[model samples]
Target: MKIATYNVNGVNGRLPVLLRWLDEAAPDIVCLQELKAPQEKFPEQAITDAGYNAIWHGQKSWNGVAILSRGLEIEEVMRGLPGDEEDTQSRYIEAKIAGLRVGCLYLPNGNPAPGPKLDYKMGWFERLKAHSAELLQLDEPVVLTGDYNVMPTELDVYKPERWVDDALFRPEVREAFHSLVAQGWTDAIRKLYPDQKIYTFWDYFRNAYGRDAGLRIDHFLLSPHLDKRLLAAGVNREVRGWEKTSDHAPVWIELTAGG
Candidate 1:
């Protein structure tokens, strides 16, 4: 089955573009980020009309995430990251679909480093690491899919030096990402297309999309215990051109059944 992720930016603003892609790509499952809408305000009719079942964790005008599957069953696992009872960012949600546990996230974009935002980003990542380790210990098929808002290596960013001082490219952020990956998780896209410059997101400013100035921040990291079923991975770049569409494109992967 095909599983995909897309940061729609705003569910209400880009609903049309998102629906068009859903019809064209027809992935078995899709995780969405940056809904920027509240739970009661989500456009339920549009998604239901597309023949998908979905669940969301949302707030207003900022971060949100959801999972949509075509007739596939999902068991709710978690809503937010651990380690902070008072934190209210709608950035994480986990669910189980057909025995595969999936963690959908929209990690913080801690811009303007050397500030409180950067500190929060680091602390959030630490919590993620701890929770991820627990998931790994479950020893089941687990896929961590999300817009991580991080570039772990120079190869993942188009202009590495230009982003050196940026939160996404800072040393600490990259190191934390490395620590997560080192725990026997395979970066599906990188593993599938090593040495190839493939990007899943581009900025809306200064012609970043048209000029091909993009970053490979979206990821599907599978635990080593679930790698046997690895099938295919790809980025649906065509959808990025839709009217009022998100800067981020759709990334997907397929896995074999009972491998």
Candidate 2:
């Protein structure tokens, strides 16, 4: 089975590119972030016409997640993280497709750091860690995938020092991310391309994409069940160069089988 994750930036704005990639990549399951629309606003018929069944958690003009599968029934599991009831971002959605518990997360890109946003980012990480711990105990096939926003390591970024002050590359933020992987989640991309600096996002500024100056923030983490099933991992870079495209590309993995 082929599974993929993409930060679409906005579903409506990039619908064509998304559709094209979905056809070209042929991922059996696709997890999307930054839908940037309410649940009712999602183009249900359009997606269905393309032979996909989807489940989405959406908000107005920002932060939404969805899972799309071809000829598959999606069972919604959870909507928001478990840290604070007051925290109301549509950044997370869990679902079951083909008996694999999959989580699509748009982790906070806490900018202008050393402030409340950063604090919230760390807090959200804790919540994810707690939730992931519970899921890990299940010991079933699972995939935690999306634009995690935290760079897994310095090698994953272009200039580690330049990003030192940013939330995505900050030590504290990365540490919190590390805590999640420590709970028996396999960083699937790293497993395939350990030393290569494979980038999944390119800024829309200063010819970032043209120059190949990008970051590898998007990820796919598998549970122990996938460790043996892991077959391949990849980043679809050509999609990022399309007109009015998202900064992030699609990251994907293939498994030998799934229940």
Candidate 3:
């Protein structure tokens, strides 16, 4: 089965491009981020017409996530990341489908570091770490996929030095990501293309895509049970070139049947 993650930027504005990609890629399951719409504003009918059943957590004008499954039952397990009852952003959604526990998240961007935003980002990371550890204890086939918003390593960035101090590439942020993967989860893309500079996102400014200046922020982290099932993975790079497309391209992975 194939699973993919895409940060749509603004789902409504990019609905056409999204539908087009869905038609072409035909992934069995998809995790979408950045819906930028309210709960009642999600385009459910349009997505349903594309032959997928979906469950989404949406917030107005920013941060939302959703999971879509093609012909499979999507049993929503959670709408928000656990451990933070006061947190209200719609940044996570988890579901059970095809015998797999799937988590879709949009980690906070945490820009203008050395401030409250960065503090919230780190706090959220801590919560994620706590929750992820619990998920691992379940010992099931699990895949946490989404626009993580952190580059994770120098190799994941186009120009290492240029992004050193940026929120997404800051040392602490990358360390947090590495720390997450260190908990026995396989970074699927890196596992397949160890040394390759594979990127999943490009900025809309400064001719980033045209110059191939990108970052591998979106990712899939698989639990031990599904590690050996990983077969193939890639970035649909051309999708970034589409008119009005998101800065992020679709990142996908193929897994063998029966993990």
Q: Number of the top candidate by lDDT? A: 3
Residues 78-179, model 1: lDDT tens digits: 999889999999999999998889999888888889799999999999998998899999969888999999998898898898999999999999999999
lDDT of 2 by residue, 158-190 (tens): 888888888899889888888899889899989
Model 2: residues >4 Å from true position, as ranges?
none
* Location of the lowest summed lDDT over 10 successive residues in candidate 1: 236-245
Give the Å shift of residue 182 in candidate 3: 0.7
TM-score of each: 0.98, 0.98, 0.99
Candidate 3 lDDT over 99-131, as tens digits, reads 999999999999888788888898889889888
What's the CA error at residue 221 for candidate 2, in Å? Answer: 0.9
Candidate 3: worst-modelled 10 consecutive residues by lDDT? 162-171
RMSD over all Cα atoms, model 1: 0.9
lDDT of 1 at 198: 88
Q: What are the per-model C-alpha RMSD values against the true structure? A: 0.9, 1.0, 0.7
